[model samples]
Target chain A: MSVSRFIAAAILATALILPHADAGEVAFSERRSGSTFMAPETQAMQSNDTANPGMLGVLDGATLWGKTIGAAEKSCASCHNDASTSMSGVAARYPAFDDTLKRPVDLEQRVNLCRVDHQRAPPLAYESRELLALTALIGRQSRGLPIAGGTDPRLTPFVDKGRATFMRRQGQLNLACTNCHDDNWYKRLAGSAITQAHPTGYPLYRLEWQGLGSLQRRLRNCMVGMRAQPYDADAPEMVELELYLMSRARGMPIETPAVRP
Target chain B: MLAVAAMLGLSRAALADALRPYAIVDDAIPLSLTGADGDPARGRAVVLLRQNTCLLCHSGPFPEQRFQGDLAPNLQGTGSRWSGGQLRLRMVDASRLNPATIMPSYYRIDGLQRVAEPLRGRPILSAEQIEDVVAYLATLRDQPGKHE
Candidate 1:
């Protein structure tokens, strides 16, 4: 028996003994044992009572709100009023097919278009904090709305394309998003557990980035992890992908600028 | 107590005794190195120090600390699933095994650098540190269930 074989046998035995081991149970046990891998001092800070600032971008967005731009003399307030009310549920139906453009358009593109045509403001750079802040503000209006997208017929092909992109295996791991997020979500990967890949709350503030970012940015990051060439921000493929993701999270309430670990 | 100890000894002996009979080490190291002999206490220190920043991508048993990353998988029970060697390989160079892994290799023996090295030719964690982490990981096993 080789050292590897011995280890394999031991693991097999452990697995057999713990046949019913679930990630949640494992995490729970680690917590209770007081033998947790994490430091005790840090544990107190992570307790449920800790209040995370929910949406930081909203603060930046409020400042930009109603700011005038464009040659035609228009501001965001020209069309949308008191964003908390009039803009409500607007983001839930985005990444729709633009009949004129003959492609999918996300909220970001729409905002840029509004800047280009309505406000005459220069289109904000992709992945810029300004764009993310604007998107966060816009998405906040749709907070609590169910994600409702892809009802139009023209969006069908794009949705399917996005779905294919998500399911296709890429990179050195030869893994699709479905592998971990869809199939092995309950399974362990190192010390952490996987969660369902829900996009309901996006344009979120991630603990990883310690800043606000859009769902498209998150998706591109995942693509980079997948070793796949990511589509440019607000690109047709990315918009289509967002549409697919939004459709998948149809009923989940939008947690705009969500906090994620 | 003696019987239980004897049983544990027998089990260890049986595992140790079986080595070399069915042992096989291919050019590509197998992914079965669980850090059975690793020391968790040492790993904890390594995590806190500049070596391996497992905390950078995960929120784990340590929440009091800030700057822990939330993107990658957590490292609570990493020892239970991965062998010491596997963990070492992952820490040294995750891209070699999983091309898409966002993890940076602590050791660059094979000259793989996903990002520029903060310390050239120095692993984030030493071999002994890897063992310590494996020890810490082993402690994560056997806990009561809790809500994630």
Candidate 2:
């Protein structure tokens, strides 16, 4: 056999095994997230907790954890008690199925539900400072743990919905999520490197925004870039897409309160 | 990247000028496009457009442009390699050649999913717009000393 043919066979074998491997492991570990592709100065910000502006969100979230709010006058601490213990690893397992909701709900949505139902307080508005802070605090607890959840049979339907949305072309630009993060994640756009669309470091502080925002905010930004009208903050489509993203990011470590450019 | 983005935004105002109807189909690499004369100046505008998003996936040799994408081939010397007809087909639709190409069809609009309401049946670029881009790209023959 020719050397080229032997190399081709090896490549073909690996491609065949990729799907089964992705089933339980991290999606595209071979392809690094956008974080690894950024300039050194930007990466440095994500590394040092103090230098990371998203840390501000974390600090503010800590205050919200203790302060009483809503008509119930209850705080996140009242029931969950010391987040480090109760919420530990919880963020990693999000986009989990909620029996009451009967559909998948992301960590942000879950928080809002708790605020309205358990705490008797109004749900924080999407991308609101309070919402980002609280989400970041919870996410901080799961730092370094692989993103998890979506294994249950109940989640399969929503995962399919999310996958369809990801693959489907949208907006005036006629671009899909796969067009960038999947097909061209390693390629450069202008001078910026495209990272595989992992949801690892969300509720992250972006240099462009100069503020912290939830993953949904980032999704909305992408939608607008496609010239598509974005779904509302609490839309079901967002939840489904989040579920699909979480499943794909199954084993990537959480990097909440992350910084980005 | 930001500087490149600004330049693209400013130059794109030239893309939607006057365009006549034209159909693009698959046959050869540089498909024949004799219906209307190609316009390099207008073509340059389409490729540099931010809203049109050509720069988002491909790069080319344009003196005024600062940054270019590297996802696909560089368009610097395409004219020396393929004919205008072939370029027209690519502009019309790339999937005909490689069923799995990531390149978006600049002129094909059928069977698309999730297009904006006002642009449901419209091609990404009009026929005359495609001709302009083809004309511009054809002028980019391989020049030894042209690139730095």
Candidate 3:
């Protein structure tokens, strides 16, 4: 017999004996942070503040916080007065309900809203270095704290919408966010480990991107990978998804300015 | 697991025409996709190809591979478990069997949304490639701990 035929025969006789699991939700006690899936060196990079490149954005943000900008000539420091004291644990509970908008707004959106309402400044562009720096600074204050988002009773509907989005199959690939992140966490996709979709790290540095980015950016990237139409940057669905992710990661410790491969 | 160049006597030029329509009979597609038997050797190569994204979600008897996904069932003994026709329908589109399946419909084009610009209007696999993979899967019939 030809080598291919022999191998084929061997494979056929031994199929379907492997065990498989039905799709379901991951339990809270079993939840894992994304860092657990990274290489030791990469994890070390995130653990060491000096070695972490995201800290550079935090330093820049510190400078911007005090330097007055915008028509109001007021800076983030003018009103908030020391992010360390006031903003501590703020990021951990974001994607919070907004009474004015009748919807939830993520940390980034809140920053933009502050700029619009108080600073009299035009909202910074998404993924802009300044926005990333500020968010990185704010997110860092919440590092080591447990995520507490999606707790607002008013946010129930938005959170539900976000969960639906995560579970729904979309795009040409016909996959849902839950398909890989939920069912295949700890599995390898090509060469990379598939981590659970948690929002523990935000304004985090990704080695592939070589810069800090928001959770929305990551969500859009996944949609593109699914061969699906990504939501617009300002879409409410983006905040909704972020809200749901924060809730899903309810008790996981925050790892702002995190480094990921 | 050496990669084999496809030699199914077919070409991209041969697939330029519209997708060949096939009727599903109950749970199977009982006709050759390219009107010819596919080469099992070439089909095996397609399964191992990284771009196909199969190994990302499945494990098989390929000992040389260091990382294999555990998302889906193991690919061993597929031939014994499923008929060639059923496997063909699956290769073309598994969602017909289970709507919530994470598997991509390799030979489907319509109803898919927001395909990347470069891949728009094209199925994930060609007719020949699908046939080749089906042929290769059908050869995976050796039972575990009871190899023939």
Candidate 4:
């Protein structure tokens, strides 16, 4: 048998017999991570926790975690206790599959589920300040840890969908997500550098924005830049794309509330 | 873990006057032929204006813009690299050279997807805007960092 044909046969057999999650760690481009593309001062802003504005959201989150709310009169602390223990490593493994939902959910959605189902509260609005605070606070607990999740067989379908969204061309520009972040890493436009589009520092602050934002916000901004209509908040496509990004950033450390220019 | 300490002032500098205002020419003129001489000043406007957002994705010789993008080639020496003819082709349709290029064609509008409802079937940059930008870019003939 020819090598190419044998390889194809092996791949088919693997697809039939095994879940796609077992296909190994996501293949990330090693050329340059997102941080590398940042201006040096932006990097500095991210490293200094005291100076980072994202920490303000973290503080707000800490307060929210302790305050009892909802019809059940419960706080995040009521069940999780100390976030340092309960929430640690949780953020790193998000965009995980939920058996009940039968699909993947990013950390923000998971927070809403806890509010609605566990705490009997209303779901927080997407891109809300409160949501960002909680997410940043939880994410902070996982600082320095590599991104995880998307390993289960249940996530394979969503992961596949996410990959398609990332690869597919969209917008009036007809550009894919990979066009700048993947293909043009180290290249300069106007004056800013492009880096590999890793989602390590989400719920992060941006100097350009002068405020905190969710990954979805950034994605929407990219769409606007491309002159494309943005998807609605909590769109499944957003979650799916988030999953693909998390999987691609498997080994990279988390930098929630990271600062950027 | 190579942390760079960007001590250079990271102030948000807007080159508000980097580009001067100019009027658009005609669209029917042949793209291959340069019509009324493109006003470099107005061309700069098409590139640096916020409504256009070209500065958001490209860096150039605007000293006033403290923060410029680095997503594609810096426009420091674009004039020396490609001729006005070449620049026109790129402006009209960059995808013809590299289908995968992220750079949007300034003029072509056919077969685009996901465009905002308000901008359907309209090109991002008008033909006059393209010529103007090309003219301004062509003036960047010197290499970066050296005074002409």
Candidate 5:
């Protein structure tokens, strides 16, 4: 082949290899779940249900799903019986659009909404153990399914708002989420490795926290690390950010109750 | 007259606890916070320390360290790249220059929100520590690291 023809072929190959490097998103083929960056021990802990501490929350959730509570005298089993069948693939499409509130609500918020609106029960507090357990339980049903968030046309504006939050600089550090997760993922920050901020493992167990926590808890921790003020527990901004992150991991597998460093 | 003197003394005490005033001239704070030059040895200690969070995002000329970071520019040759006054400004608040830097404002206390309760109302480093870090950084006149 002619030298110029060879050069042309090389250029085409490079384009095919790095399709999204310049499009401001990680390429489809290059995306990795957060678990890929964990140490072998942590990975093992997440894979084994008996060994995983997050499974404790799932166990608690199983009990809560069946226990009768509130004035309506009903359990979650009353409406959504047999979660393994009813809740399957439900979490994969969450932080979904809510028509009544005209915005997005995460799985935790959805659970609380059900308690308040249907069961006439008071809303669960954010980060409460019961909420984590229920979310972990429901989220477990979607384990291994691909995420399908941010696909609704109604969520376009909220997703854009979330993306803006991800890109905006704040705190004394003046760093945006992109500066770590988007620009320098897989790099080391002191003793810790920075992973892509995927929302695949909500209500996952973090070694530092020594308990299962929601994605909002982790996001709040990062903001505090940046020396920035965090949003309120039930802030719409938090839901929007969760929605956007789930959108980013659209085709990635869910690992609810995942263990992490 | 006695009451007036007591009020004046109280205000003076409050001023002492606040940040030292420094002027910015075209991207630099040309005066020392403690009104004296800092010790380079002490400055080196501050840079290497983990609580100061410098090495968490910056790789420098220290050959003995195993886990330096790559989030920011290499610290080698920073002495030649910038003046001491410029370094002071960067250490105090890098955002004044880049507006989007991940480097924390080591000596700034205002305009920050939701700082953890334990660290509220205080700079990340003391005035003397900032000066010491500037002094150590000013001595870093070596060539860029191979990792760069």
Candidate 6:
């Protein structure tokens, strides 16, 4: 049978057996009571209040920022001096399309471009610990700045695609990103409540992960739960999704390396 | 290789009789109450296998089943704290009790997926499987001198 047919059959079988099945009979000893999900405001508050200990990425980025690389005999500081000054408010304007490349460029992509063109250094691996740290460091410079995506006309289509992806339902639970984040942000799902998909503060530490990760990594995790294959780290779909998320959180302050549950 | 074989043998002995084929067919198996007598040996096997996947989020006394997750509560002395019914709810469908639980319902109704058939509604575990898991959890008593 086709994959679609199999999925359909599986879903139907599940529906038929569930109603007759006993309700609230099975239990575990360590079941957590009360709300299972986090509320958006609470989630944000927690992220803001907590300090991340494993923010080694920012330190790494700081070290690399001033180091000269390749035969070009230059460093990131060669073009932009003192990130605290020149690069401040830069992260909020990202996931923007580069007119020269005709593609959207997040801060990470832009950094890699500089590495190749100016520094003559190899691009860092996507999702690598070092890359995440560099991105976090650069993003941290723009902390408290309002998100400024979608300023470029070339980014319009991607923003639309991302919005559609956010609202589209998938997975065995038949849930869309908007169902929990938009419609039920205040409601609980299992043990935690839903939080808004704010991408302003990222490359943050999560209690669940016990380490730092980028916004894209978190997005991939959600897709896994949705039972849909996630796009590759640098995939266009992911870029578009980032575009949509940044747009949604357009005015939120950037909070790189924020802590989350 | 010898150590591996020994560990597998120990696990098999712990798991063997509790999860027989008949247990799979029967939907109304008895669950062990927290204060009731329990066989920890049987519980050990149920947790180790995918039948419970409890170890997915928790760290237990078992040294061989190490995993890196803290999503669920630790199961070391769970039997002493909660009643059997509460445990059943957590395993069968955590969403009914707590909406934010990431734990999949081992047994619950179907609606999360779009479908046309009847059997593929929710989960692979039946009611009996849930009871068996509960029985295993009842054995997690704290040993007098052992603390971890």
Best of the two (1, 2) by lDDT = 2
Pairs of residues clashing in candidate 5: A229-B113, B43-B132
Query: lDDT for each of the candidates?
Result: 0.61, 0.77, 0.83, 0.75, 0.84, 0.63
Off by over 4 Å in 2: A1-31, B1-35, B144-148
Per-residue CA lDDT of model 2 for B1-148, tens digit only, reads 9999887655443333322345543344343344758677777877888778788768877667777777767887888876787777778776655444566777766666666655555678777788888888788888833321
CAPRI class assigned to model 6:
incorrect
Query: Which candidate model has the greater DockQ, 2 or 5?
Result: 2
Kindly report which residue stretches of model 1 are placed more than 4 angstroms away from their true locations once superposed.
Answer: A1-54, B1-148
User: Could you give candidate 1's per-residue lDDT for residues B1-148 as a string of tens digits?
Assistant: 9999899777655543332211124212343334245566666777755324466455556655555655555666555566655555556455555443446544433343222222223344455565566556556543522311
Model 2 chain A weakest 10-residue run by lDDT: A17-26
TM-score, candidate number 1? 0.56
Cα lDDT tens digits, model 3, A117-222, are 9999999999999999999999999999999999889998999999988888777787888888887776777567888888898989999999998999999988
Which regions of candidate 4 deviate over 4 angstroms? A1-33, A36-44, B1-41, B48-50, B53-86, B131-148
Off by over 4 Å in 6: A1-51, B1-148
lDDT of 6 by residue, B61-141 (tens): 666654523434567777766456656666665555434344666665454543212223435354455666676666566
Error of 4 at B47 (Å): 3.7
Which numbered prediction scores highest in DockQ against the true structure? 2
| TM-scores, one per candidate | 0.56, 0.83, 0.84, 0.75, 0.82, 0.56
- Which model scores highest in TM-score? 3
Query: How high is the TM-score of chain A in model 6?
Result: 0.78
DockQ of 4: 0.24
Kindly list the per-residue Cα lDDT of model 1 for residues A1-261, writing each as its tens digit: 344564566557546754432221123222111112224543333232234343557767866768877797877877887888877887888886777799879888888888997887799987788888888887888877877877777888988888886776654223467655554454444344455566765677666787777788888777665445566665676887789877666666676766666
lDDT of 5 by residue, B109-145 (tens): 7777556554566788888998998888888887653
- Residue runs of model 5 more than 4 Å from their true location after superposition: A1-23, B1-30, B61-67, B80-82, B107-123, B141-148
What would the per-residue lDDT of candidate 5 be over residues A125-148, giving only the tens digit for each residue? 999999999999999999999999
Error of 3 at A251 (Å): 2.2
